[model samples]
Target: MFQRGPGVPTVEVGALSADAYLLDVREHDEWEAGHAPAAVHLPLSELIARLDEVPADREVHVICKVGGRSAQAVQFLNAQGRDTVNVAGGMLAWAAAGLPMQAAPGTEPFVA
Candidate 1:
């Protein structure tokens, strides 16, 4: 399994603003259902091919529906020398925390 460095900081939804980059690793449909405001969608399936989309200078927070995929993403990005953090508990936790979500245009909602 992948692991982050000791004492890596994680931002809660309430504390997140526009300072860092939010990378959503969920599938297309899941992302369309709901996601953090200003989050950039880069489905796990396409991450490897689209790494250039992420800016290296800023903090990147990886998120998925729960947490698994985001963990994987963090591992991959870290291996590539990119600074990334996994959003523990993922979007589910974000919703539980009552964070705001926006519908991604042109995408269909996921039933599950």
Candidate 2:
């Protein structure tokens, strides 16, 4: 599939390292529903206030339910001088690629 936003740096699921720093920009429920096991939770809606939580020493890999919000986050983060990349197709592709995920206890892992 084509990249989601103009000038948005991107990486596909296949190229992602299991140890890569991942940022999930979806809402809490969506994150609880399922997300990359190593991902950091920071909703796009709360991003500005919680910007400090983002790690400054590493390249941030961002994702959303789809590519939209994460693309926006990448743009914002890059503008703020954080090296970041959008996960092309976001969680949809993440799940399709069989990437590891974590969810609430006793619940199935899935993209919400």
Candidate 3:
């Protein structure tokens, strides 16, 4: 059986708490295009190498362009005993909710 951690809880954008740590697992280009305002860019490719950067005490909301990569990431993190949850529907859902997206510092607004 897959055991879930105590802190991690998957939630929709509308249900996400402002205080939660949102981990964006999309690629650099995709993240630069647009992402949740509260999200931290940690592209899936580098996640394992940077696992130590994630705080173990806080809940981590993992997200991708859709939900595939995030789901995969959540599984991996869970197996590694890290607290993580997949943000269902991902940035697409967040955008559909009319949530605000922050551009990279000093960069132009994301076109996509």
Candidate 4:
């Protein structure tokens, strides 16, 4: 996928703890399909307007169906002076890595 944003860092799914606050930047439908139970949902389209929802003091680890969107987001957030990083490989990798997720009842978990 895209290399981490210009100066932004990345962390593998395995390296993160449940305590990490994952920022899922996918759309509403994608998020509804499945997402990390602990992740904060803020579609990229709304990120700028919802900046206050993200913790300024914490390092936000962003993700999407794949790495592209999240990498783009990392660049934007960094430019805004927010501490953020791309979760390399994104949700696809996160699922393959066997991370915890919450899907709609009766729905099979998959990156949307």
Candidate 5:
């Protein structure tokens, strides 16, 4: 689900700190279905308009269902001079790695 591109930075889920700043760039349904417990929601569709919601002081870990959309978000965030890294293998790998995830209160957690 992940790919190595020429320039955008990437990191595995294991490398992240327990409290790392995670940004979920998936669509609304994808996010609501399941997401990292600590992630901040900012769908790629609304990224540009919500740029200020992303942080500049701390490194941002961007993720999506797989890696495609996150790679795109990382590229854009990097170009705009933000410290961002694509979460390699995205949430699929995250789930496979047995990391914690959450869904809406009435739903069970799973990768969307």
Candidate 6:
């Protein structure tokens, strides 16, 4: 189980939806390697500046290489009044769960 931070929530990586408002917060290199097939690529470095792009009404699932960055993002976004959850175990767990992923064009798929 994940440590809950104040208002932040968490969901198992296997339970995520491809159609939900999934946010990938990994770095560019990590993203370039591969990511959730339907996730929106909004690196954490750009999250604050691009906060407007995140839907305030929807429950957002934030993910990174591991749960750390997404957990931090969940904390921040929750403070901003956006309903967010950390994708527990992140990409590694997602891949382990046999979830679909997409890599950069011409590259082999692998979780970064």
lDDT tens digits by residue: candidate 5, 59-105: 99999999999998998888788999999999999999999899988
Q: Per-residue alpha-carbon lDDT of model 1 for 6-99, expressed as tens digits? A: 4444556556656668999888888778888778999988988988987788779988887777888888887778888888788988888867
TM-score of 5: 0.93
- List ranges where model 1 is wrong by over 4 Å: 1-18, 104-112
Clash count, predicted structure 1: 0
Which lDDT values do the candidates have, in the order given? Answer: 0.78, 0.90, 0.79, 0.85, 0.91, 0.86
Candidate 3 per-residue lDDT, tens place, 1-112, comes to: 2333444456787888878899998898888877777778898888889988777887789999877778878887877888888887888888788888877788754425
User: Residue-wise lDDT of candidate 6 within 1-112, one digit each (tens)?
Assistant: 2233655588998777667789999999999899988889988888889889888989999999888989988888887899999998999998888888889999988877
Listed per model in order, the count of residue pairs whose N, CA or C atoms clash below 3 Å is: 0, 0, 0, 0, 0, 0
Using TM-score as the measure, the top candidate is 5
Per-residue CA lDDT of candidate 4, range 17-38, in tens?
7788889999999998999998
Residue pairs in steric clash, candidate 2?
A: none
Query: What TM-score do all the candidates reach, one by one?
Result: 0.80, 0.93, 0.83, 0.89, 0.93, 0.90
Candidate 1 all-Cα RMSD: 3.4
Off by over 4 Å in 4: 1-5
- Report the lDDT of model 6 for residue 31: 94
Give the candidate number with the greatest lDDT.
5
Between the candidate structures 4 and 6, which one is better when assessed by lDDT?
Answer: 6
Cα lDDT for residue 35, model 5?
A: 96
Candidate 6 lDDT score relative to the true structure: 0.86
Better of 4 and 5 by TM-score: 5
Error of 1 at 55 (Å): 1.3
